[model samples]
Target: MSMDAPTFRVGVVVERRPSKSPWVDHAWRIVAIIPEAIGTEPGHVLGHDGEAVLLYAGARSVEFHRVETGNYRDNLTSGSPGLWVTLALTDEEPGIRLISVTADPAEGESLTEIGDLMVEIAPMPPEIAERLAAFVETHHVERVFTKRKRQ
Candidate 1:
């Protein structure tokens, strides 16, 4: 929440829809990544209008690091950059849990190695893009590539 810090908080919204799957009653997916969810509590149900349930899953921190600027730059520059959200669910649980929100594509993709968690890609909001771009502009260093000598 600090204006000058490398970290900021965002709201995670999830849509829970009744499922036709024989084993599961509902299916959930991230519907939005709100720039600021300062006052909302996690797991609060926003609305349910017969078909889908909208829940303010929680607020999560998207942090920036100098060393990861290159990755951030790559993410921001990509034609379709996204903010990755990771949600967790257990067999006995009724709703999914917000595990994390990340701007690094690779780091987020790596999280898919765990099959149980729901990993989704959401379009990066302008607010987040601005901050990410600023961080990259300030800290990203272009590493020079050198051809290897055939010894």
Candidate 2:
């Protein structure tokens, strides 16, 4: 088995809006994933639609593991394959940071289960989906599963 893993870099575009709930001041949501990185400041505002401000939080990598090619293929065939984005906040940065993005639903859900990081999913762009499909094609290996008898 090869240890090589392919990664795709994406700009995590976040939507920042005033929170209606009193518990928090602002509500942050992952709105989109730019398939390619735009060489701009992380906190640069891309647009505001009166309801929310869109900002480029930071760049994150979507890594494809050789062993998880099956999951990637499942995601692509799920009819609504998505790019999952994970965001986190820290005292070091004083703002949200793009931690990770993945095409594998299981990994994405595991990150969401962490309970601290904010996770969101957006429809995967056709181009990126194609690239992922190609990666799956190149790295995917079929394994036979055998059920074990209980003692």
Please write out the lDDT profile of model 1 over residues 19-135, one tens digit for every residue.
999988888888888866778777778898689989898888888877788888889889878999999885544478888999998899999999888899999998889989988
**Which digits, one per residue and each the tens of the lDDT, describe model 2 over residues 1-151?**
2357777678778888888998766788877778565678788888998988988888877777888988999999999999888888655432677788888899889998887798888789888899889888988999999999999
Clashing pairs in 2: none
Q: Return the TM-score for candidate 2, rounded to 2 decimals.
A: 0.87
Model 2 residue 58 CA deviation in Å: 1.1
lDDT of each: 0.85, 0.82
For model 2, where is the 10-residue window of minimal lDDT?
89-98
All candidates: CA RMSD in angstroms? Answer: 2.6, 2.6
lDDT of 2: 0.82
Off by over 4 Å in 2: 1-3, 90-94
Candidate 2 scores a C-alpha RMSD against the true structure in Å of 2.6
Q: After the best TM-score superposition of candidate 2, give how far the Cα of residue 110 lies from its true spot, in angstroms.
A: 0.5
Clashes of 2: 0
The residue pairs that clash in candidate 1, if any, are none
